[model samples]
Target: MQRTPNWSLQQLPDMDMGQFRQWQALLEERTGVCVSDQRKTFLQTSLCARMREQQMDDYQTYYDYVTQGPLGAIEWSALIERLTVRETSFMRHRASFDCVARYLHERLSQPGRQTPLQLWSVGCASGEEAYSLAIVVEQALIDTGSSKRDYGIWATDISLQALEQGRAAHYPTGRLGGLTQAERNTWLTDTPDGRHAVLPSLRERVCFSRMNILELAQAPLRDLDIIFCQNLLIYFRRWRRRDLLNLLAKRLAPGGMLVVGLGEIVDWNNPLLERVPDDRVQAYVRRDSSESLE
Candidate 1:
């Protein structure tokens, strides 16, 4: 009897510079993510893993297969999911969330503020950031004696697999380190399988959607009260990063805050946004029309 080959153990041939460039261009064109020369091995490994699963041995053939027609589109989705990184945790950046809490306090203090606050979490992986935002908003409302205030969080990512995980709102116990004991007690319920699941009260406030960063211009979210886009721009070219920030600026409501990962972009400015001048966080606020006229 003939032996079936163990594709998992099969050695993938080295990807040459030409092949690397082709794959790199395809990723950037489709996802706005730049794969650097240093990440060549990473790109190769991801491609090889997917190629092995597809029983494809040739690089160019697999590349063509991912770019062709309807079947190619499905394959591309799987390939892109492998390429994207989804590492995240609840309240990953404390200072940034602190900034958000402060902003919420001020907004809630305003007279006749909007009934429901709108928040967006760009590149939200597995829903941690979105749920964290929900926690902050809910706490702020309670502290300010505005418990009846309504709010919504829009969490978006490019990977469908990640979005599904976000929708599930279940996480391993190890991933809850960023949450305080009180927070965990309030927002999480113990799962039978040694995991923590976000309580439905928080989950219902967030809507997870698959969104390609390059296609933000067409997204219908507008006048958002806050936009948290962190640890995402590092994968894109500087120009594309600036372009994405500009589009985000357009989506912010006047006086709305935008937070990004520090050092992600340099010398970037938007006419409608003013730097928040907080040393602890890289953030900006959309200028109110009255402030812009001054």
Candidate 2:
């Protein structure tokens, strides 16, 4: 009998269209992320990277392994961390933050408004967006002479590892591209090894947790003052995007602000929400009961 070869060290075979569709369907069913046909290589690479670690060779074997049950559920969690796109930085979109600042400034100017502003950073990977919001809110309060008003950020993502990183609140200098020298000095603490950590004041204001936007119906978040859901809907189908926006709209308090990526959506009509027209940013402001859509 011939000796069997060790298949684990062998390179992955070219993924066929059927296999690609299988994996894509699995991802979409579980996570609502629709992988395009062109992203076959991306899916293969992500699957194969994990497979190599487990010493599993064929995509079929890996597929079986990932769909097996309680074990599969555990494995699936690990896989998504590697698969999901987490490329984000501090203030990835300046216009959205500027819009947020304006909203907060208006609220701060209101008379007898004591409620601490509640904000949610949906799909917040590694915490930069959340921390940036904190910085923006801090600056906004100061700029509007309402320093006494309080606010907090609920930063959530599907990846537990990312959430842990968010909780740690440390970031490399390279990721601080959007921060100005003054903002950096005021909001971040320098470490000896060259990384910057968020200041305690800012860190304390952000709460990081693992959350899946697909399961928002069960989520504890409600009556949020602002919801920032940018750069995330692009992976979802149009109907799912509308579903998510509708769910997010329900979570917003009256007069709340919802900021999404520009051009990610168009004509998402909701009677209670009106789009804030800006040349650089796309946003919606929730209306009071009297302003319901016709």
Candidate 3:
């Protein structure tokens, strides 16, 4: 009798287009996930590695494993963790922060206009963007003796794992370069291991959550403020982008600011937002008022 040899998933054939489409649909349905054709390479590498780890010869077996309940949930969780890109570093864009600094200066310089300084660091991957916002807010406070004012910051992302890392608020040495000399002196301590630690003071100011923009229709955010929903809409289908923009309009305070990534579009003539001075930044001021939300 001939013996049948067992092969790991890596030894199996490449994913056929049909298998890819099925997996894509199932993933989107599972989490409103959307992957561009450009990311096919990323999908293959991550999924295949997990399949091979199970000693499965093909995707069907791997798919079965994930659909098998509790154990499957664990596998799927791991898969999602690997698939998502958590690429971020401090102060990735100097221009945006500069804008923020200028805006806060104007606000704080005026009397009777200061209250709890609220800002949203939307898509704050790995905590850097959130920290950056904290720094900006802090500088404004110090300059105006407004440090005693409470700050409301909500940093949210679709990946729970990414949010976990952000909550930790520690970074390797290279990531520290994103901070300026004065910022480092105030908010960070150099670790012996060539890493930098974000002081608890700065970290505590930010509230982190696992939130999908699509599911944030009920997020308890309202009134006049600043929103930094940056660099996150690149993956959405066109229709979804419009849906998100409309939703954002409702949340923005009248004369409040909405800052989108360079990749985002608000169709400035869309009747909801008036374009700010800088066209490329996609900054807009809301036309809605608190009376409308009520």
Top candidate by TM-score: 1
For model 3, residues 156-233, the per-residue Cα lDDT tens digits are 887778888888887886776467888888988888877788888888899998776768678788764788877787
Task: For each candidate, give its TM-score against the true structure.
Answer: 0.95, 0.94, 0.86
State which candidate, 1 or 2, has the greater lDDT: 1
Give the CA lDDT, 0 to 100, for residue 18 in model 3: 80
Which ranges of candidate 3 are over 4 A from the true structure?
Answer: 1-13, 67-71, 266-270, 288-291
Off by over 4 Å in 2: 1-11, 147-149, 290-294
Model 1 agreement with the true structure over 1-294: per-residue lDDT tens digits: 122346557755678899999999999999998999999989988987888788776788898899999999999999988999668999898889999999999999899875699999999988889999999999999989895859999999998988999999999977775789999999899999989999999999999999999999899998889999999999999999999999899888889999998888989998899998888899999988823221
Winner of 2 and 3 under lDDT = 2
lDDT value, candidate 2, whole model: 0.87
Candidate 2 local Cα displacement, residue 189, angstroms: 1.5
lDDT for 199 in candidate 2 is 93
Residue 168, model 3, lDDT: 83
